[model samples]
Target chain A: MEDQKPTSILVLDDEPIVCKRLKSALEKRGYEVEIFFRSSDAFKRITERNFDIVITDLKMEGLDGMAFLTEVKKRSPATEVIVITGFATMETAKESFQKGVFDFLAKPFKLGEIQDAVERAEKKIKGNIS
Target chain B: MRILVALDTNRYSQYVVNEVAKLAMNTWADVTLLGVESRKPASNGTQPPRNLPIVRKLQEFREEFLGYFKDESVSPYAIKRWGYELVDRGKGLLEEMCVCKGMKDFRVRIRFGQPTKQILTEAVEEQSDLIVVGCSKGEQCTWEQDRNAPEKIVKAAPCSVLVVKEEKKPTKIVCCLDHDSVSQESLELINQMVTLHQTDLALVGLTESEHLREEVDQKMKQILQYYTAQKIKAWVSVVDVSLLDKFIADTAEKGLIALWMGHKSLIGKFFSQDRVGKLVRSAQSSVLILR
Candidate 1:
């Protein structure tokens, strides 16, 4: 029964389609996912509950991905943060690694790409939790 | 096969020489030692002495260097040349020496030039399958300060460059995957490197949302499928944040890890720095970060 506990993931993105698509896709694969449309909402929930992985879009209206990543690390240092963004730059990529982001994803990303990220996260989580 | 150990008469050069000898012993390839003298102007401008004493000392140093390899069965030759201006001349001399020895299968030519360009050009011209270079400690002299040589060689060389900083064997390799779109290429490269080095492969996926597990799974399947098709020997495991420490520990076992990150995934400014630095510093294994 303990082994059957669903891998919990937190998805933070403003886009409804992205969240819904990921949520549905992840749920089908036996993972429990929580979605947040706003960075603040995601931050609040993160403080309230533990997540194995956190995937967030880099660009948002307020409390952008980096800031969200910082808060995530502050609150749940164990949770691995992966940032997804459409605009890719070398400086930002370096910064993500410096900030200890587990991985970086570019926008317009394929479902398979997101899945790959989740798989890596899941592996990390399993190693930690079990 | 012949290997060239570019000797610079420095401590770093000794390590390069030792590693090359070990590799030669393992591969049974002949070794060549090349000593290059750059005629760049001295900052002091006193026409720094090129006295006969200095020449005699260099010759003695060369002989002493060759003495280290005397016990080994490898046929060794030494050549000394002066100045970047005479690079073509030096190469010609090396070519003549190789022909004279009647050893055509493999030849190692070690010479000092602008370390990066000379190595790359000679590797291509010599059709070397592998180029091994020692990382400079940079403490004693500023000669090898540019660690960028490895990166530059990777970009330009026709063959693979084995950049050796310390004597270490890779036990774990981290393959950074974005999706199946580029996974095949990434996996193929990873598989070749792992098999060549006899190392384990760790698959790392970065997700933007928690709900992307299915997508990630499918991609992993694709990667594994390709590896299976190729019949490459590797241990594949998926890692997420929760199990990162365990993954790190498992990878740290051999104290050497290679991280394969596709350049495409490096898109955008927000996530770049953190991603690069995290993998660079945290892992216990020596990192081979591939672009």
Candidate 2:
């Protein structure tokens, strides 16, 4: 496991507990993970570093998920983003797709579901690499 | 069913025509090739060029185009027709074809609209099950600007919308989920679409917390079960942001990627914008963004 190249992921959410939980879960799976509680901070880190996938929450205090997604696309054109929101609506879903989101997830989610999403991301990333 | 392949003589339009024709042939549906002549009226409003001449020329081109299909042994059973009227003429032709073809299951109409409103109205009126549209090639346009056709169609259409890129195929389908309730509906829809298309399915998730990993895994199991019941093959992968691009590049290599529209996570939102947009604009494969 150590010899294998660890896949890296970035998780951005306003909740500290959510970040911590995600970081721990991903690290257990042999992924190098980073967490950010604010969209601005997350954007700063994203600009400075390259990540394979970015998971962000839709609604936040300062910079919402939609605005952050715009910035991420501007900064890293190749990174795949999966959006999670507590407020899910048909309009928001359509808007997210129009904006070109990779996937959409609503809040109060299951851990297993997130794992499936990561599995897909890892497969996609590895496929590109090899 | 009546299938309309509307043409404006653009390269992408030609491609769409070919694809629609192929679909029509396979489905054994009646096909109509209609070309809309968007000629500006004479400055003095002289008898705006007789419809006969324009129709004749368009008919000739249509025959020539269809001739290739005939040579390939896919006769369209009908000749191509054109008219000078814009939406009204197009709609009339469509309705006429529907009745003439004795269509009972489905009817397809393809025409260039003012982009948004006209197309949306036509789609609603026809009660279409699916609308196939071409994305503008080599142009910079925002979703908010100038009646963005693809965006508007996806949002306003009562049914599914497939935004076709030039020479694109729907082969690889990627479902982005957040292990949430909303994603369940999106997953079901993705499963149905992928199965119908006989495409490969990939489930993607982002891991933000250690506690959630088990939950993510359980959800993956459920998805696997769903696909298994449908006799559809699928693979699931979980990655954090660091590995997202590599995942996309890999899955896209096979064909197109289909993503669920509303997954509400920070990463989900990011994927919606940067990753999905990049793929749609430049990825070698086509993308289906489902809402």
Native-referenced DockQ of model 2: 0.01
lDDT of 2 by residue, B1-291 (tens): 223333343445556555554443333333444433333344443343444343554465465545545633223343222333323343345223222312112232333335466555664554333455555543432322232445555555554445565665567677665544334435534544553456788777666642235665677787788666545678787666566567666776665566554523245353544455554555444456654
Q: Worst ten-residue run, lDDT, model 1 chain A? A: A85-94
Q: Model 1 chain B: which ten-residue window has the lowest total lDDT?
A: B95-104
Error at B210, model 1, angstroms: 5.8
Angstrom error at residue B205, model 1: 4.2
**Candidate 2 ranges beyond 4 A from true positions:** A1-130, B1-8, B22-99, B102-113, B136-148, B155-157, B168-171, B178-199, B206-222, B241-246, B262-279
Q: Just chain B of model 1: what TM-score? A: 0.51
Model 1 Cα lDDT, one tens digit per residue, B162-234: 4444555566666644444442223433444554355566656644433335655687676666555444444
Candidate 2 residue-wise lDDT, A24-92, digit = tens: 988898888999988888888977987878888876768888888877877876777777664444455
Per-candidate TM-scores read 0.40, 0.45
